[model samples]
Target: MQKPHSINLSFLAFIGVLYSFQSILGAITFQGMPAVFRQSGIPPIQIGFIYLLMLPWIFKFIWAAPLETWRQKKGRRTNWLFLVVNSVAIVMLLLLTLTTPDVGLYFIFILLAIIAILSATVDTALDGFAIKESNALDKNWVNVMQIGGGYLGSIVGGSLFLLLVGRYNWKFAVYAMVVLLLMMLCYVLFQQQSVKELGQKSAKQSLQKTFASKQVQYGIFIVVIAQLGLRLAQGMTMPFFIDYGITLTQLGVIGSIGGATASLIAVFLTGLWVTKKGPGFVLISLLAVQISMYFAFYYFSEKAELTLLQASFLLLSNSACVAASFVALYNLLMRLTSPEQAGVDFSLLQGVDTAIALIAGVISGALVQYLGYQSYFLLCALASFSALVALPLLNKSSSPLKVVI
Candidate 1:
């Protein structure tokens, strides 16, 4: 393992800002739009198909190696790619503003798909940059930026966007997003430091070698088991809220105020816990909390009536657990990535994570429709429990391959 590097607060802050841009788009496409569609009377099954828009993220590893090579050959930093991709994404968002659900729903979906592809590309570049810049000791804070900034973006894209749409109009909401993206782009362009290059050795790294590592294989298995149930349960949350008579503004308020606050706190604390106790311990502990939350959600779903306060409590608590678990999981994956092929290795792990979550999300709505919310939540709990049972295997697998950190 490499000796721990000195922490650079400016670089971490830049990473947080960069990740916020990607997550803002994600929150809008995945969370905000789904609630809007559900409110517009779209069926849950049809709403489920929205997960497919995120397919680029699931398979981005296919192109990650080539992109990394291209960057190395050109001697261009990841920040350059980040700027270019986000610029295209901004244009795509502008195009989306021309279309509405009433007349151009399919067009809007198509544009969002293009934007997802751009955002996934940005994620690939950003992950590689973060891995290269930070050493093992400070990597937890890197993930804090990734997950914490993500929650912050969710407040803007998921919560604030909905609030704007409810109070003003769709175009106004979208224009707000456009302005934010432009500001992020400007910030990146003005930054003085270029990412340190990976040089000849990294340029020689291949995806084949990355996949063959035992650590990579074990990481894949752990991610799939840990994330699938959580994503499945989360996929239905907004829809369930809509069906349960929660208004759009109320959902926005919950996410903006309660959800963001709880998630940020959880992310920060988990960063500290993972630093002190290690990711494996933190993951198992948080997974237990997540399982309990799922069961609580199950109990709530069966109620004849749920008060706003009750719903807010459940959502906020679950948000915190989700944020913490993600921090731990990403910390583990970061340790699995070799710096030589950081882009390919990390992208592959994240790709697997996204693929499983995407599948679960795609089917979650139909399952909820078929089995009802109570049964669906119970099923999610069982899935999470199975992951908890399998956690020991992750430890066993780690013995064969020294962690790359």
Candidate 2:
């Protein structure tokens, strides 16, 4: 049997770097390409079909049980699976770079969907590993790194990658992405494994026990409702910017840089704040701030006049708030998991959160079509406010917020 490995700060940082690059890779396919598609005259309805690509994420929990069961069999657990899935994703990305989607959007979307599945698989494994390995203090940092890395990835994948494509060509941007992915892959290949040996427990029983816990049930509720409004608002943002005359290159630079900056700030700020105040307070406060951001967008949208600086400010401020909320929410999530069933428990919670967000994302275009941008923005604010319903559930005396699972 393998000895349990203590969580290390350096390994957590390494995961941050890996996650950042993963986000970059994901953004290249999701964020970057969607902008290109819209720029090429694709309508919102047609482009909204692109959200179907997220199908894998919506159902990734289906594999979580198998992954957990496999962990019990010993021998490096899901690390090899992670490697294999990421390798496939890299290959798919290379293919995407070689093939021009302008000729047939269907083919590219299908290909990207495959890549999303593989990426989600890798993400599931990595997340499970973090939950299993990290201590209470380390979980806060893990959440920070996750969001911070994602924002950084957005800068490179969404901003810089799009700029490259616009300034040079598709091939140039794709080659840059290839190089980044290669570097990420090298790290994954060499990272020291710390996964502990699993006991012979039924994955199904673990999941049932997790769901039976009221804390986890409420935690899942918060996770889903918390993310839904944010995803809905963000889903239409690129289109909203384009309507206000923000070009792809400008958006890439402004939006990405601003988001990354705000995210980094939120990472550090929320880390400290959550440690002092508890994740519940941090979650609720930041979520309220996020609601305000949506309304702010509605006000600006109604004015029908937006400067790059103003837009950047709004996006950056909102990104900071959202990042803080997300970190806090995840901090709560990690605390809810039982380490013995970390993979299944974490995946179920994350899967539901992702599935709801993806559902909102897929339907956001239709909402925009029917309600228009300003109305849609207002509706998103209402959705964000809905998360407050879960607050009372978190206050159960039996499971105090600060107590680590």
Runs of candidate 1 with Cα error greater than 4 angstroms are: 1-4, 192-201, 396-398, 401-405
- Using all chains and alpha carbons, the TM-scores for the candidates as numbered come to 0.94, 0.90
- Candidate 1 overall Cα lDDT vs. reference? 0.83
Where is model 1 poorest over a 10-residue stretch in terms of lDDT? Answer: 192-201
Q: What is the C-alpha RMSD of each candidate to the true structure, in Å?
A: 2.4, 3.2
Write model 1 residue lDDT over 1-405, tens digit each, in one string.
334655666677778888889999998998899888887778889888989987999899999988877766654556678888899999999997887766777998999999999999989888877776675436778888888987788778987788787778889889999998899789878763543443343555588988798778878878888887888888888888878877888888888888889989999999999988888888878778988998998888887666899889887998898889999989888888887788889999999988887898889989988989998898889988998888866566546323421
lDDT (C-alpha) at residue 190 in model 1: 76
Q: Count the backbone clashes (under 3 Å) in each candidate.
A: 0, 0
Summarize candidate 2's per-residue lDDT along 1-405 as a digit string, tens digits: 333444456667667776786688677766787678878888777766777777777677778667666754654655677677778887877877656757867778777888888887777767766666565335677777777777678678877787787777887788888888888777767774643323343344255676776667766767777788888886777777777878777876776567777778877899899888878787878778888899889889886668988788886787687677778888888888777667677777877877776777778888887888889998889888887655655565565443632
